[model samples]
Target: MKKFRKIGVAAVGVLTLTALVSGCGTANTTNSTPSSSAPVPTGNAGTTGKLEIFSWWTGVASSKALKALIHVFNEKYPHVQVINEAVAGGAGSNAHAVLASRMTNNNPPGTFQVHAGNGSLYSWVQAGDLDSLNNLYQSQGWLNKYPKSLLNLITFNGNIYAVPVDMQRANVLWYNPSIFKKYNLTPPTTFSQFFQDAKVLKAHGITPLALANHGNWETTLLFSDVLLGTVGYTDYNKLLHGQMSWNSPGVVQAANTFTKMMQYTNSDASALHWQQADQLVANGQAAMNVMGDWAQGYFKTTLNLTPGKDFGWAPTPGTQGVFSVVSDVFALPSKLSASQKAVALNFLKVLGSAEGQKVFNPLKGTFSPRLDANPSDYDAYSQAAMKSYQKDQLTLCIGQGAVNPGFTTAFENAMAIFVTNHNTKQFIQSIENAAQTNPLS
Candidate 1:
């Protein structure tokens, strides 16, 4: 077990490159120990203060999950007040922008949401805006609760910076089961099969694929799936880490594949948000959608759909047996007052506890990062995703936390232009130029 642990840490550290990535729910106290029942892990016995919890979790399902977790926290510590300072839009883009301004003005929140991976979390550490959480982890017994590879992503200079809350698989292909059954089609496992299905659906006047790029990151997310499916995991990681060139044959092929996929997407893709695109599939207007497991939350909680009944999911074409990790984590700001820090640290304890995860992940449509989180606490989709996370090959979700921000910015720019122009050559060229300035490694 120890030998495997070392390899897991090393392998994930290389593939993940150091930060964790981004998602959930409610309380079902079955057989497991409930963290809410334990005393507050930190702060004075009568710790009474306001803790501003910040994040981009203002969506219907996510907001509900956060509320549930807060409810549990209040049960444990009635004196502490939690201020839900969530900003909406851009899949965390708008919230992050607001957070940046607050941090710059020395008005940091007590604790804030961050992607668990290196891109966002480590960058904050580099900026000296976060405090180390090693003591918190030790106190919570989290050093062994979460996977070492996951912890490795949040650890910088031997100090862990954040506590991961939930893990979301980003390479999922969600579809309306009724649409597939009516068409007598199966979910595609390969590109050729996807095109075939798309062709059939299109001929029948159905939009084959549902896409939303309002955030400018959704298109990049689609391209990432295409790139991974085309080049396979090994080269995908290489390309992400800058060991492989942007103009490599695999990337070109991926760009071409992505262009082909766009033909089957709805004409109004650019105008729709991700949820709207997902709504198309739910309404049977679109056959399928490529998105993270967070879509599962929307389908289950917001849309009131049943898993494996109204909706079905599979790995994006050619991505079977691979898990593209997108995790959401929380961290303490360095500038908090002692009282603020105490309350914040206690909140982190609840956030990292098994009881909190059980309540939060089920409602949010994500899986707990902790190894001990009960599978029965989740739905069918989450159960499958949890098994995949345990058994499959893990890769970083592109644009989430997989690469440096410089490359991510350029990649997103290239994707935005490519969607409008379908200029494959120019898209590749733009990415190549960005690689020159912002090396992925």
Candidate 2:
């Protein structure tokens, strides 16, 4: 959510924005070049070297999960040393900046964490900085192992560019069951019910929604959830694809709902990090929080809380049939030495393998990207998420990776403005301008 200068082409004119607002797809397409063939090295080709993997998983649960996965990788090839260059803050904002700088300077890591959609992955692809994984998928027979929707997110022009480690459900509404039971309330399934519950919770001196906006993406994330609830799946996807406008009536309503919902949130929300916000709900200081399932790892591993008893979860209001997804994936950089490439490919293999996913996601509070992953290996919460993922209408999450990075940054700035001013019209206008300046297509 740090204000970032727009980095992509700014060819989308105001007229294009207006047309998109009217639900016309007339904008120019910025298609990526199809990936060329690259030789797929078998059995690592006797590779023995250091593999530097970069990511923002420095938290206790995430770091431990990465280490566990690395341990598994080492067991397969003990000669390779894995350097986990994790930079953590602002839910990957700091890491992203560092990675961008590294990429700009031509000092890329062997593999780096990127969101699975058009945001980070497509930016790298458009810049011609990524190595296609199509050969890798073919060599490993992974074409049928993963869900087609997931593969489509990381693939472009018939080329796969990244290996997704795990899938996170971004539209979860987590609540303290004890507080809900005390109030004789059940999890709300609609925004009307949500507002009614918020009023009751506020009357009893409980913050209705726990929010941490110190990282501006959290604000954007909340708005994205509301937008999905307001516009539903089809239009939300259109919005992300630059076929719909930010200034549309649905977006205005979503922004208005976001502003109204903020009224019941903790006053100190802007000063807290996401973990602190989750703590507010965990300690029963707040009744509920809308976040990805990673909060389950914090509550379970860090806070030592039981899942079903200490906290409960439901889909965000009006989003029961939708799955807003955020996946952490590792993409190979175009620049790599032969040995580094071999080790990197091996590392990706580990990431995409069933054993790695089974060991990693259970501890990380997410589910495997693969459809064939063993459900019994995950916890009750993750099992439910995996089931929902299979059955729900999938949509890309903005903060996670659904749109272009330039557009994502612009939308974050709009959210920052909306959070301070609470002007719904201005908020809509700001995002419309953002879309005009930073077109996704």
Give model 1's TM-score versus the native structure. 0.90
lDDT of 2 at 357: 89
The list of candidate 2 runs beyond 4 A from truth reads 1-30, 43-46
Model 1 score (lDDT): 0.81
Reference-based TM-score of each model: 0.90, 0.92
For model 2 the local lDDT of residue 296 reads 87
Worst 10 residues of 1 by lDDT: 21-30
Where is the poorest 10-residue window by lDDT in model 2?
A: 1-10
For candidate 2, the TM-score is: 0.92
Cα distance off (Å), candidate 1, residue 21:
17
The residue pairs found clashing in candidate 2 are: none
User: Candidate 1, residues 157-243: lDDT per residue as tens digits?
Assistant: 556778888999999999999999999999999999999999999999999999999978999988889889999887887776667
